[model samples]
Target: MSELTVRSMTEIEFGQWYSSLVRAYADEQVAAGNWSAENALQMARQSNETLLPDGFATAGMLFLKGELHDGTAIGVLWIGLTHPRGIADCAFLYDIEVESAHRGAGYGRKLLAAGEDVVRRHGVSALELNVFGDNDRARRLYQSSGYRVITQQMRKTLTDER
Candidate 1:
């Protein structure tokens, strides 16, 4: 497998990348029963905008693209420099996605390693991320990458009959 290279996402790549991210995130939310189809897209956009007010130049936010040495785009990773719990020098991974065509290959793991290296180079001591309960694949990848679950949120549907 070719080593993955990580680089800052160019402004030219942000538009299409963000669009796909928003749509996919919305779909994931809908699938997880957190949002209805009608409002998922809007909510995704709002959440992303709130997190990335300055777009690619947003302070403390890193938008990165992963590729092979040959320049084949393998995936993208979005990480935050500030840790959620106020831990200094820690980073949060907002998202990491391997292109659909590259799915099931080792690229996801490579992309994640690349992201970690980038954060480490920035002086970050640790990295964290959230994976939906239903995304078994992602959870497995993360676990195998040495990330342990520090917290979890569970929910149960309650119907009028129940």
Candidate 2:
């Protein structure tokens, strides 16, 4: 694995990536009976637009270009913000998705650092994000970075209700 580069995503490129990534994830989730793709496309479009253009929001996308020795675009992280919610001034997250081969290379830490700076600059008093309970690796990263689990959101998928 070669060095990974993290950069601010241009509006066009990030829009492309955001849509593609969500659609891919949506397809998989629907097939797995985890979610309904009923509104996937609409949601993806809305998310892409809102996520990138929100003046109060920013996302740091990571990629390994030349380092993609295997001829693949490896992702390092995805840190961004969502609309604010109760008790939280705003929501921020260290959505670190390091390329499989680059895990443990400190990309998580770097991405968190960058995202925190973004959140602080926006005048958010508290940073908040949700993490999968089963994701021990991600939990460790957040915990080490001074983020704790404030709450857990749970839902049960209902299928065949028709």
Candidate 3:
């Protein structure tokens, strides 16, 4: 297993790395036809906005950076707090990606552990995420990391031209 250091993203440090995450996901999702390129960057813009933390922007939100044995960030996990569910807060996870070569090195697990530690300090009792049903690997990771399916939301595609 490679060594990892998880830390909060700085305002100046997030631009390039975070953009790569968004672009990579956008390219793949568009190529797979899961999303439309027809939105003219609006979808991406909105996602970027919501992904960044606002209320507890410093310690409450963070990125997981994994280093090679020699030190390089081959993985990143963007994490934040979701809207409170009951009296406890929920951790919202996104932008979690491990480089193709580094996926099995347990970096993702370390990131989740780090996220749990951070949120727990703030008195959170549970973590929640909305992952697409098609992402089996992610579903497994989240489940393995101790997340349970509280609910499933279904969406119907609108055929009428917008």
Model 2 misplacement above 4 A: 1-7, 24-33, 36-82, 86-88, 154-162
The TM-score values for the models, in the order shown, are 0.95, 0.58, 0.72
lDDT of 1 by residue, 18-114 (tens): 9999999999999999999999999999999988989888899888999989999999999998986787778999989899999998999999998
Query: By the TM-score metric, which is better: model 1 or model 3?
Result: 1
- Among residues 3 or more apart in sequence or in different chains, the pairs in candidate 1 whose N, CA or C atoms overlap within 3 Å are none
Better-scoring candidate (lDDT), 1 or 2: 1
Per-model C-alpha lDDT, please?
Answer: 0.92, 0.56, 0.67
Output the better candidate (1/3) by lDDT: 1
Candidate 3 lDDT, 51-83, residue by residue in tens? 554522545566656455576766666766555
Each candidate's clash count: 0, 0, 0
Question: Against the hidden true structure, what lDDT does model 1 obtain?
Answer: 0.92
Maximum-lDDT candidate: 1
Ranking under lDDT, best-scoring first?
A: 1, 3, 2
Q: What is the C-alpha RMSD of each candidate to the true structure, in Å?
A: 1.2, 5.9, 4.4
